[model samples]
Target: MARMCAERVIELDYSCNGARIRLVRESGQDDARHREAVPAVAAPVVVQDRPPADDDAGAQSLPQIIEITAQMAGQFYITPAPGEPPFVTAGDEVAEGAPLYIMEVMKMLNRMEAEFACRIIAVLCENGAGVEIGTPLFRVERTDHA
Candidate 1:
């Protein structure tokens, strides 16, 4: 995994077979005391194979997890401003079109919204940290809509 840490955002990137997977975390402060950034480098990966009989069961048992990716690369924010509560957190229920996070690109703050009703399972990026195109900001489980 390649970790990119900045004063504004935290990014975790993993690559396998030429495919890049990114995880983002929002930071609360610009200070380094917030969290240590992981260096961006190609990390060793291990692959495991499951027996044929387990394949079907595994596929069925796994819950569907949806990734919310960044539309453009820039800084990711969890709040509208400094010292404010984050827009969303893990386990928060969100409706379609709800504002989830914001990306600051070229001095513009672009709001990112949810595409469908879901519950946030995890937040991948840190606030004020830089991210790349298609970097995942959140992992959510789709919820049934009325």
Candidate 2:
């Protein structure tokens, strides 16, 4: 008996700063063909102006908010399993290496952990929502920074 092979196709489209980008991939395609389909361009570097330092007695320091993005496109989950409480919620302080969320890709669950201690300011994505690569999942303030 002989077995037959099936081809797979995947497409992703998104917009950034009014520029729309699209990606399409089909199984069994050569590297040259894939490269021709998508051209690479250098990303722009943004420089932000820093606030002037106050020499006076009443200087206010603001907490720096950081946005955590998805490393890969997948289904985002807050809990490890169905009916379970989330690993972390807004206003929760998470230590370094603590599990923050999970991404389900190709039937495999990938646990996302914090690289540094942080306070969860907000959960940006809904549980069980499909997210693309570079999608913002959470907004957190670094607690380890002084």
Candidate 3:
């Protein structure tokens, strides 16, 4: 049994006697039963680096866009209450620690905040939508970058 200390999930790959096997296990799961098996000949691994930019001059001047993703799986909410206005909208400037949105997990509400001052470029998730961990919630451009 493999122990997952800090990670929430773990994936492992094994090759034995020309057979390829993939094992996916979540934290706290003790079972290691083989899940997916594929012929070694049918599986190929490919790794590639980013291609060079076409126009270096323009690329260098472009503003950096940052994506904000959910830290946990939950139901996403735009406003604190049903009749209240949303915490933010596209083009809104937000300060560090400002509330961005709310996430409801297991009937508990968690307020999400901005880590740095930024301008909201877009709201990626729909209101009242179910979201998984690492789901993109917003796109923003940092305003405090020096």
Q: Write the per-residue lDDT of candidate 3 for residues 1-146, one digit (tens) a residue.
A: 43543443477788999799886757454444634332222111111123434787764566657778777777899999998999999999999888889888768787777777889899989999999867788888778752
Q: Which 10 residues in a row give candidate 3 its minimum summed lDDT?
A: 40-49
| Candidate 3 error regions (>4 Å) | 1-61
Whichever of 1 and 2 has more lDDT, that candidate is 2
Q: What is the lDDT of residue 102 in candidate 3?
A: 86
lDDT of 3 at 83: 88
TM-score per prediction, in order, is: 0.56, 0.61, 0.59
Candidate 2, residue 50: how far the Cα is off, in Å: 9.0
Greater-TM-score candidate between 2 and 3: 2
Model 1 over residues 48-115: C-alpha lDDT tens digits? 12322356667556555667776666788999899999999999999877888877766767776777
Candidate 2 per-residue C-alpha lDDT over 40-106 given as tens digits, one digit per residue, 9 for 90 to 100? 2111111212443464333235555778887777789999999999999999999988998888876
Score residue 17 of candidate 3 by CA lDDT: 100
Per TM-score, the best of the predicted structures is: 2
- Candidate that would win on lDDT: 3
Model 3, total clashes: 0
**Of 1 and 3, the candidate ranking higher by TM-score:** 3
